[model samples]
Target: MDAQAAAPEQNEVPTGAKQQQAQRPAEDLVWIDTPGIGQRGGIIIKDLRLSIKNGEFVYLIGKTGSGKSTLLRLLYGDVPLTAGVGRVAGFDLRRLDEESIPYLRRRLGIVFQDFQLLSDRNVYQNLAFVLRATGWRDETKIKERILEVLRNVGMQGTQDKFTYELSGGEQQRIAVARALLNEPELIIADEPTGNLDPNTSAEILRLLLDINHRQGTAVVMATHDYTMILKFPSRTVKIDGGTLHEVQKKTAEPSDRAKE
Candidate 1:
């Protein structure tokens, strides 16, 4: 990654970035509450009703097969359940119908560590494709949206650069921008900074925190970076021994904080 980061691209400041910086407070409801799952299984979330506030940062910590990703996936209706209910941005999981999945996805943003950028197209085209798929057709509007999202992710100049030519951080930033194109209410990031080094990882996490603080986009990051848990120290929600509770009980409001 360092080899690629030898030069930082000239990034342009976006007008919409400010709008994205402001976030509205969130209301509380049964976000992802699982009374339990299956008569005999390994996916029981157990009364795990959770709320990821309108603008919050939550770290989901747990070992492999601990259902961390499953819980995050549940928010966007990605995981089909054997039993249990979850809701996000007003969509219910128990009654999660196929018709409503698209609606639910529009309000949520998801980021993956692998930087799933299109290998063939340049940065601009990758983002352009997403905008078109989501219903934006105006050429002017599409370019504006693409530039806006790229600016928000701090990679405005890489619009013509191929993904393979970019550094790991840059590639990940593009993924983040793609996730932001829809301006989702909540962002679910799984191992977002996993492959980067300590310094690069910190920079990426700070960028995420900035997104959380500036735009009020509630973020749920499932990672093994307990060191980051100590470094940035946002509210934590650990799936230990199979249970969910506040990390410190500081913000019992339910909408804002969950951890420990």
Candidate 2:
């Protein structure tokens, strides 16, 4: 597909790169090695093992019902597996039942396409709600973090506005700002730009890339936009018929800005 590199000259990363990759830790690993759960439902995912490393920008390419969203929920502990195991930010997913789920999610930042913000709360209040709910005690730290993440998302001045008053891009930025409240090690995004225009989508991608670079926050994103994958090439994992394949693009360098 247009999203993948020309099938790789071979099926491996550069030798030294692979060595470094393998040397990394197994913790904070956001991937699903197996699937299927709940009383009424059977397995939705197969033995779907994937390991995304730290500071890497990865694209989850798959079509609808290909289990993209479900995969994300699994990482955030929203979906419990029937078999196999998953480790995200040092927490075990398979063993995490209702009680441990809160702790697992608190370590992660999740952004959704629908911008899950409260309509009744202003941007600042919305962020404050999460900070207080999650047990942030210091009033000063809460205010500081609220401002910090908002500034990170380029929405510091818009904090006083209602969610409905912002553009689609701005609303998404607020959602991202909220996600950053926990200072999470991993940021999971599901179709984050599905509703935005191309220009806005590029801005969001740039923001995500910047956060990934500055904070070394591992990013796992699910998207149907193969064109987006082509523009900013990175390690991509594709799922179809419950299979996993790692894609290594020729890889864009700073010198290849024109190509990008």
Candidate 3:
């Protein structure tokens, strides 16, 4: 896919450019150029370009209201792209109809800060709900898939427990298992560690990294945890002053360690 520079104004919808970009072959899981994203009259993010390839782990860092969530929403079609080109999971953001949104989401797994598990249901029921909704018909297959994903996330024995019965870290592990149920090509984790303690947060991060390594699923995690970034450095993207900037990872020197 060709990359083009974009400079979009608020309230300007570059439909033409979006169409052109969508028609090109998608070499990346997500490719956007100066995408104006948000509600029609008010654009939260303007002229933002980002590209995330398969099997890549990227940290999206920005202060609250810096459009990190909005960008993630754009990828999953929660927010419409008002301008610029965006192709996510082979779906053209410009021409994505409501009917196609679910199909697009099937290729994506979203982990939110709040574990949005059904409070009234046990782990098994919660997972079964998603499988049923996604058109998994065979009872045996659904049961087997649930068991497999639970084992994958190391939460194999917690299936009969309710969400309230699990600790924060355990709940997060269940959430991760839920995301892995469909074997999504990309997992968009929006503050997955936000509600956990530091130790639990570290464990969650390690789980995500393990999933990325073993499953080859691209992970775009939006977080404010600088400590985690310093400890597990990778490609980092920051949103500041309404634009996206790639933060270079610097190797820690002996002096830096001493200061720590």
Candidate 4:
């Protein structure tokens, strides 16, 4: 991304680019500025300020209870932003209501750590459900979209199989395909690789990176696998002490194991 080389230590905009970035709302897919975030009158995050530009892939890393999930929830409008400015794909987060949440999500693709595929539904039915919920009507168009996303995730021709009949990796691939069904501008992935084995985790990471590059979709993935971060370096942020910090990139030594 344009800001990778000059990432800030904190959540502030990179130096020398504030004037440039301040003027480009159209270029930023996610924009947030908030004093705090929480539920039930408790603050989990404080002084949060973050921006993710179009097509950028960013890793969100932090320990449990460090507010990583809370941050992602805020981005998707699951948690209301009680104060400050917050926007995602042109929707005002602070102003999001029950009626608008679905609309906001239609423009986003969300992947969960558990895969979240319905066990009772076949792959095609799972995908078709999302398309229909998002206002797709024609059966022909829905079928085409389902096949297209399945192909993108390298999981074609399994549309007839139940999700429970698939392996973990295959199931996750279907989940990724579901996230793509809407052609969303941004993908919010929360611990997408957490449940996979090492090799499968790498596969999922590579797939997300591929989509970020190929489709120009901004991705903000929260993960605990520092190993994956080492193997596939990218712009990353760490949530700590109720705030966010940019992690300096580290060069990884060549490893045959990582290659596999």
lDDT of 3 by residue, 1-260 (tens): 00001111211224543343344344598899855676657777777888888877889999999989988998899988767778887678877777677777777899999989999999999999987777676777778888888998889988899999999999999999998877788999999999999999988888888788777788899999999878877788998888888995553332332233
lDDT of 2 by residue, 223-252 (tens): 877787778877788877766677674545
lDDT of each: 0.71, 0.74, 0.80, 0.80
Candidate 1: where is the Cα deviation over 4 Å?
Answer: 1-26, 37-44, 81-84, 251-260
Give candidates' CA RMSD values in order. Answer: 9.6, 10.9, 9.2, 9.1
* Candidate 1 global TM-score: 0.82
lDDT of 4 by residue, 135-226 (tens): 66677767877887888999989999998789899999999999887777899999998889999999998898888777888889999999
Q: Name the better of 1 and 2 by lDDT.
A: 2
**Candidate 1 collision pairs:** 21-214, 33-49, 34-47, 236-259, 246-259, 247-259, 247-260
Q: Candidate 3: minimum summed lDDT over ten consecutive residues — where?
A: 1-10
lDDT, candidate 1, 1-260, per-residue tens: 12112112211113332222222224742265567543245554676767776676788888877778777777677776445555577655666666556656766778988988899999999988876666565677677777877888789788999988999988888989988877777888999989998877877787788787777788889989888767677778887666777774343332222211
On lDDT, the stronger of 2 and 3 is 3
Error of 1 at 3 (Å): 35
> TM-score of every model?
0.82, 0.84, 0.86, 0.86
C-alpha lDDT of residue 64 in model 1: 75
Quote the RMSD, in angstroms, for model 1: 9.6
Candidate 1 vs candidate 4: which has greater TM-score? 4
Error of 4 at 98 (Å): 1.3
The parts of candidate 3 lying over 4 Å away from their true place are 1-26, 249-260
